[model samples]
Target chain A: MRAAGRRAPALLVLVSVLLIAADHWITLTPLRAFGSGVYGSLENVTSSVTRWASDARRLETVERENARLRAEVLTGRRPTAAVAGAAAAYQVVSAHAIGFGGDQTVTLDVGTGSGVARDMTVLNGDGLVGRVVQAGPSTATVLLATAPSSSVGARLETSREVGLVTGVPDRGLLRLSLLNADAAVRVGDRVVTLGSENMRPFVPDVPVGSVVAVEGTSGALTRTALVRPFAHFSTLDLVTVVVGPGRPGDGAPQ
Target chain B: MRDPARKPAGNPAGRALLAVALVLLAPVAQVSVVNGLGLPGGGPDLVLIGVVTLGMVLRPMAATVVGFAAGLAADIAPPADHSIGRHALVLCLIGYLCALVPADSSAGQRTAAALGGTLGGALLDAALAGVLGDESWTSVLGGLPGSLAWTVAGGTLVAVALVSLLPRRRRFGGPASRAAARGHYTGGHHA
Candidate 1:
């Protein structure tokens, strides 16, 4: 028994290392799927506990969003042509944020059954949330916009200058990079997604956030800025998944 | 004749069952209650607390198995990123290292051990992931302080509670117990 005890820990360590190597090399699809299923059930139980409070909070948010949209329309800052086109082209699938994965990811209630595929853009009333990384039958894991591995192409609304927006995990802010040093970007400039090919990941003109600060002195080859994402990731309750192209015959004036 | 020191301290099957329960419960609570608490980055890792607590009580080999199981549960838990087994490797080392501390250590000492294990585990996990190119330098640097603070705070609480709650086994007619009786008989003369 004494000898066995000494060898047990070493054996466990060895097995763990091998498992890690295998997970890295191959997609453990069934295991991952089982995990997702269990996670979804737990999320449901927990979500129900906070359902009333979340509903109240969600109501406040909806009212606020309605007021903001009304103000935008009154101010003639309504959706641009590209934004309108994208909106008309994509159908939205509503989902609730059931749980979070680690520091930089969230799990949504909607998944493959709801037509949520990998790389589908997810957003809420506030703004961009993230993109779907893994889709199970009933659950989807979203890689938040502010995750360390997450990066999005964004363009300044005013100057149309483009850059890559990456997550600053520590600061909970998005860092915009690869901008020209002499670009006319300023504090409080609106940032929106530049969209991706076929709109698989991001759709054009989706509200990202506003620039908070630009790093580095002037005349550098490239500049970076901190962006305050409109989506309050930590408090996400409800979100929308951009499923796919909208109905073909429902074209409205762009 | 069996040596008392070599005998397992508790029911092996019971300990294994307890370890399995902690492994399952920790991650669920971590994602649901802890994360729901609205911490900025995320809640302190509850799974690490369970592993560290077990390490302080269980034998080295048992602790290692528990740690590996806990880490595997964490890897499969939702929101888990990077490759699986990364957490397992860190935790296995932590469990083995923590078991080296004497089980009868003072509460303060045990608390320190738990704190060290958690902080060390988090750092080692990050370092290993960074080496594998799974994590960036900035992310690791940025997250370390907050992770340390929360883990220490949580670990200290768990250590204090566990130390007080765990039953102390007294061997019948053992020298330590006899010494205590002798002290009492001498009207605290040993003092």
Candidate 2:
């Protein structure tokens, strides 16, 4: 009795140790099924909250624009082409910025279940954030535009000159590289995604950010523009991952 | 039930309850509170700090158990897809390292060990990912400083808080040691 009593704590500890070790082989198989359900519910709650917040902000902007447009119309003119063109350029959906994984490489609580999907793009109200790398039922990993592996085809909204936007992980900055050294691109020019057929992932004309600077090459074939992404990633509270309204050529990688 | 506040020392059942509480509570806290306070890359790993603290105070076998349980909680995170066993295995190593800290360590030493353990484990995890081709060394290294600072800060804060919360026990061979004795000994008979 004494020996058994003495050994009991050790034995219980031993058994738990074995069970924990078992976790290495199994991964999240059984637990994840349950976790997904929990996360799914949370996603609903957060999505609704974000939608309300964004709607309020949208109302503010619209009201201001309404005042401005009224002034323009009062001068005996119809809706100006510039104002109409801007409205037709893009659509916005609101999403909650939910939880993240430990390493921070992945974000969760927004996906196809909440109307997000692969190849669809996401952004903060200010500018482009990232594209959906993978979408699970109720979760997705948004490859942030600042992630090192991220690359996007971009164009200067002013000149319509094309370039590639690449991420610098360390600085949390994005760079736009133009093929022609003397391309008409300049600082403060609007940068937007260069949309290709099907809008495969990103539809054209979404504001990414403004060019912050132009860098000279030691031996460069292309000119690189420093881009300060508009999305304040550090304090991101809400975002919108664009789901399909079906652009003419959307679905595959652009 | 005997006085709930005064359970028999070394009771397997009570210990089991404690371990279970740690496992269940750790991850839930990590998800709800830790992740809710998001920084750039993500929030600090609180469960990792908790496991390291307990492991430092426990026996080798017990530390491993705590490490396993805590790591398993972490492994249940949403991104379990990209890296499954990475945390579990890494935490197991952290538990073992915790046991190696000197038993007579000062609070500062324990705090240092906890911070070191967190940073070391994070680097190991990043390196393993690099080897797996999931990420490049430069990319992982770029995020290293910020991640390390977060882990160390979180660990130190939790350690200080836990120490403050636990009732102070008189040091052995001190003036009040005899009166403060709890009548529990691992390998001795008391009359």
Candidate 3:
């Protein structure tokens, strides 16, 4: 008994080190095969619970806002066109977020199976979420809007000025750089994805986020701005992966 | 609180059954109770706590074997996306460490040992995530307190419950209070 006790600690350390090493180097096949059913069930249960929780939370917030709006309605004022348009851009599909993987990436269960597809954009109805990096049978990996590898050309919704939004990997923040010198960018200006010549996978007038800070001189060769992402990616429960309108010559996958 | 009646060392059958029960309970509880509760980042790592607690009571080799088996089971369980042996290795280390503690220690000491075992497993996870540049502080911190708390509580509960239940089910109870029965001799032993 004493002898066995002495050997236990050494064995445990060795095992732990091995497990850590393997989680990094190995592929997902065998592991998934072993636990897929269990994970699938857990995913189903958790996703439903999160959906319910978010719905409940959203209702409470709407109730408070609705009460405030009721007073305004009583005074005989209707929503202006601009206000209605802004609200429309913030609307989302509200599908359940499920199954995470990759190094800094995660797969959402919304794919072709959920009407999501390649290059289709995703968001939280607040700001940019990400684009579908890779789509599989019923899952897609989102190259998040905050990923270092991501770059989105966005324009100010109100001013129609353009800038390049880049991801700051370490801080999980998005930085907008290389804007026109005379661009009327401000701290609270709305940023939206601009249609690009190659292909506009995202819609033209979707509300991405508000500019939080601006940098560089007016005459500086390139100006930069910091945009606060609308989506709370960390605690996000549901998102909309937009299957945007088809681009030209994409009917048969030329 | 040493009992002077029966031998302190447990029989092979009793030890084997205890190991089996722990193995079965680890996965079932992890998937059902831990995940069903929705405490945090994901499911609770119940196999880790089970390995640590079992390691504290069993022989070192026995603990290692059980840990390895439990880890394999965990790796193969749902929601895991890596290889099959990752958890097996981690749990084995936790079990081994718990077993290495001196036998003369009390339950209080075992709790400390179990804590070390749990921490060792968690540290391995954090360090690996850090090296790969895949660390997410939000989910880690979000789920950590609940996971750690449940592990400690669940580990302790299983350990004590098993210890109390084993002897009673074998017909005689209360710490083997029959030295003569344990020392019973037969078949030509007419001294």
Candidate 4:
């Protein structure tokens, strides 16, 4: 027993190191799938239990949750004018935020099974949530816009001045750097996604955030500004994934 | 203070059950409930606390194995996008370290070990992220203060509770103690 104990920790440590190396050099798709398949259902069960626990005694604090959910229901049932306009343009699927991670990511309770392919844009009533990074069998991981490693193509909603938006994870904000050095920017100007060629990652006109502070000088290579995202990352719940372009007469719009 | 009749080691089945529960449920609870509350300072890392607690109970080798399993669960659980085994490495080391705390150590010593293990695990996790290019050092440093504070708080709370519970359970019952029933649970400590 003593001999085994002396060797086990060292052996396990070596195994862990090997696993890390293996994960870096290769994609462990099967292992990841197994993890998601097992844990995803567990997360769903936990989320449901918590939801039920909170609702079992709907009181003062619960009222706020209820109100927030009510607002969410309204948004889902009847997309606002802005969202309605955007909703008219895409085929979307609804999902719940079943889990969150410190890496500035979230697990939605929908995945490839629900047509939530990787690179699809995810959003809520307010604005862009993020893009799907991984789609497991029944769950998908989303890289939140506020993640330190995240960067999005963006532009001013009014002037159409294109820029790049990167996450300022420290302050839960986004930094927008306009392409044109001479481009005009203001504190209150609204920012939206510049989007991609195929609209796989982002769709044009999805409100990204509003500029809260302009940084650097006019003569700088590119103008940069701090943006406050419309979506509340802290309280995310019901979200939608754009699977494809809408057929112009989809039932959601009506 | 030493009870001769007590079997120094604990029940094997209970410890195995606990280790499995910690491996499975802690990550689920962490991602589903703890992270969702949007608590200030990124909240506490529940999985880390569980590892420390289990480490103090299990033998060094068993603790290491359980920690690795639990960390892997936290790593691959749907939302994790970091290098797959980052958590496994940190947690395995922590679990081993924790279980190494002498059975005769006082509550203060065990508490210190628990907090130290958690801090080391968190820093190690961030360091690995920086080293592996998963996150920049600046972002990690920026978020460290809050996460560190809360994780220490959580570790302290859990450690204290477990320390308190262990001695009482051992005293109230001999081999049948719920906590001490682990296959090879030791009983030299007195909280």
Which candidate leads in lDDT?
Answer: 4
lDDT string, candidate 3, B85-137, tens digits: 65676677677667666443445665566666777776665554444454445
**Candidate 3: where is the Cα deviation over 4 Å?**
A1-30, A33-37, A49-94, A98-120, A131-173, A177-184, A194-206, A215-225, A243-254, B1-89, B99-104, B136-191
lDDT of 3 by residue, A189-242 (tens): 877878554334555555666778887778988778888877776655567665
If both were scored by lDDT, which would come out higher, candidate 1 or candidate 2?
1
Q: For candidate 4 chain A, which ten residues in a row score worst on lDDT?
A: A77-86
C-alpha positional error of residue A31 in candidate 2 after TM-score superposition, expressed in Å = 7.6
Pick the winner on TM-score between candidates 2 and 4.
4
Identify the runs in model 1 with alpha carbons over 4 angstroms from their true place.
Answer: A52-88, A178-181, A216-218, A248-254, B1-17, B100-102, B105-109, B167-191
Please give the lDDT score for candidate 1. 0.77
Give per-residue lDDT, candidate 1, residue A19: 80
Give all candidates' CA lDDT scores: 0.77, 0.62, 0.59, 0.83
Each prediction's number of clashing residue pairs = 1, 3, 11, 8
Provide the fnat value for model 1, as a fraction from 0 to 1: 0.63
lDDT by residue (tens digit), candidate 4, B1-191: 12322223356788899899988998888889888988888888988988988888777778889999999999899898888888998998999888777554567887889889899998898889889988898988888899899888988897788678767645555445434433233433212
Give the best candidate by DockQ: 4
Output the better candidate (1/4) by DockQ: 4
Cα lDDT tens digits for candidate 2, A43-150 = 445545655778988789779978987987788675334323322344434665565444334455665556666677776656777777666667666777777777
DockQ of each: 0.38, 0.22, 0.19, 0.45
lDDT by residue (tens digit), candidate 2, B78-177: 5443444555666766776775564444567767787788778778777866775556688777767777777878777855754553324324234333
User: Which ranking of candidates, highest lDDT first?
Assistant: 4, 1, 2, 3
